[model samples]
Target: IDRLAPSVVTAALDAAGQGTAETRYLVAGAGTMASLAVRTLVERGVAPERIMLTNRTYQRAAEFVATFGVGAVRWESLDVELQAADVLISCTGATGVVFDRDRIARATQDGRPLTLVDLALPRDIAADVTSLPNATLIDMQVLAERAADSEVVSDVAAVRAIVDGEVGTFLAAKSASRVTPTVVALRGMAVEIVQSETERLEARLGDLSDVQRAEIRRALRRVSDKLLHQPTVRVQQLVDGPAGLTYADALADLFALDPSAVDRVSAVGEGATND
Candidate 1:
């Protein structure tokens, strides 16, 4: 409710006139809802000194001023506050009209617009206030309509779209990353084959010197590296594109990659992540 309520207030401000630097915000209640509304105003760059709080009791207004660092108004000075305020939000639980027609009309006499946000349950601002010129009233009905049609829903939809896009991007990245484990497994298989072949040659050549063994190992390693390089590079680039999964399958098949090795690598990675 806190997240959503402010957008309605801002929508009221947008539908009405955007205030000038001289605009004063008058909140006529000191309730929780009123606090949320004031917080919204402050977050939107409304200076604390430019905001005035009024209630039936002066202490309530004073408490709000102390806590929020805004100005305070007496109950009797509501009309003067109304006249000074460019934006008026009513959260008072008054059954009758708080800012009646006559006072509103008189307050807006200087041709300045007043944005009235009525967030009361029993309806603080009169329904007839809309008929008055230069008085833009955003009551429960308007706020409901705004919640349904404009700002709030639009913003949510926009954010949801961005989230969906990011999810798709993440899936693509995850798919591209799958090929890396396959590449590592293929390299491991090559090392096992090279070691087995070296062992066989050493047994056959029985009396070979350490230097001859090292030379043979170096030549075989170079051949294996050169043979794997092109395939690994091509697969990495293609893995970022549409047919990445198919390429991974093909690589596994072509290299006769051991599925157990990839699973072991994945298990190790999962263990590391858990730790």
Candidate 2:
């Protein structure tokens, strides 16, 4: 929050026509958020000499002077410092309002433009301060209300789209995995049939040479592979749809495959995954 919230202050300053290099910042706290706001101001081109730091405890304000190279004002001098400031960013952990409307009106009686930012919970600046002339207030509630209309919403929509696409891809891959055991069992049955036929042919045709027997075995295996290729590919493609598991069951029934064979293949696949 220390990093993100300060950007709102910069936006408010810009909207108020408080040029970074010339604007005077009166930061009314010595906490982490306040220190970061100072750093933000300097990084955006505000002169360190023009920024002032103050806290309820005077020593707390003095401690940060070496780090930020800005003037330190005691708590008693806050109003005096406020009159000279172009922007006031108050984020003190105060129990109540630090600057009421009347006080702000007095500070801006000269009619100079002032931007007040209240980042505290109970609010360091009163809500009615906006009624004062030549003063604009941006608080937490204002930031929240404007957020949905900001450019950040478009970025958020883009991120959500990417996440949705990834989830769909993962689900499709998981669905494809469910029919793997069936495919493996069918392929195993084809291999056993090819081996048995090749052995039977060799025994019946004893006069045939080794080269002729090898050629016959290769041709039979190629025919089996070509016939099985389209069905296996189609089954895998359909498994990502609504009736995925039903297609696997239909394949098993049509082939008259033994249940034990598919179960054995499934067990082996599971063991490999665990390993």
Candidate 3:
């Protein structure tokens, strides 16, 4: 979106018969695209002080004043700013047309030329602005028509495939992380149970050798692991599906797993990262 702004500005200015001359600019947004537009203008030798930023929220516009070294306008003062500006680059992403013919006519009543660049989907500038002698409107349709015959240099499909793969990997890893604590807690429970049972068995069979005791403990652990294997794997798979964390919650509830145990596991992981 940022990269597209320079082309939009260049084409709009050319259509208005206005070249890249020293002129006042009113950027009708403080969003990412607006910030990029301001940066692009500054890079093209337009003084930062020549640009002004405005948004629906006055505070948002004010926040960027220091960063961009540009003046900020209150939302209510948009009309006042529009009148003073020679070029208006509007990308507010608002629902309705921000400036209609009447507003533009009033702003240009003094015979000042105003070039309006509407880069929004539901265009910020009204189509009727073209009717005014002093006002020029350049919208998305104009840009699209200009680029209709342009050549494609990048492999769009390959880029989309890479994006899709990265998004999928991110989501799967996020799902796995949510269920990891429960899995760890379940295994910890199994270990405790196996150890307790093994100790009881050893005490009852005092005649057994150390080798026999160790074998009994190993056998108990194997039995516990086998009993747990399916549910642990299934819970993880279910979380990645539509069920999400519902299955993880169910597993914890059914086993009456201690919530603190999960918290402890998470805390230990955080401590390890800090180390």
Candidates' C-alpha lDDT:
0.80, 0.82, 0.80
Task: List the candidate 1 regions with Cα displacement exceeding 4 Å.
Answer: 1-18, 149-275
Q: Write the per-residue lDDT of candidate 1 for residues 1-275, one digit (tens) a residue.
A: 44655665566556556566778899999887788878877877888999999999899999988788999989999998888888898988664677788888999999988888887665688888889889988876675566656667765456446646866787776776778778888888888888988889989999999999999898888889999999988998898878886897799998888899877876776687689
Which stretches of candidate 3 lie above 4 Å from their native place?
Answer: 1-40, 50-157, 266-275
Taking the tens digit of each residue's C-alpha lDDT, what string does model 2 give over 150-234? Answer: 5544533453465468667868877987888899899989999999999999999888988999898999899889988999999
Listing every candidate in turn, what is its Cα RMSD in Å to the true structure after a full C-alpha superposition? 16.5, 16.5, 8.2
Model 3 C-alpha lDDT per residue in residues 1-275, reported as the tens digit of each score: 33455566555555545345678999998777687677777766778888889999999898878787899989899999888999898989676788888899999999999888886655788998898999877776666566543521122223335546866897898888778888899899989899889988988888998899889988998899899999999898888987768898889999999999988887887687689
Error of 2 at 4 (Å): 4.7
Taking all chains together, the TM-score of candidate 3 against the true structure is 0.54
Query: What's the true lDDT of residue 189 in model 3?
Result: 91
TM-score of each: 0.50, 0.51, 0.54
Best by TM-score: 3
What lDDT would candidate 2 get against the real structure? 0.82
lDDT of 3 at 214: 84
Most lDDT-accurate candidate = 2
Candidate 1 vs candidate 3: which has greater lDDT?
1
The better candidate by TM-score, 2 or 3, is 3
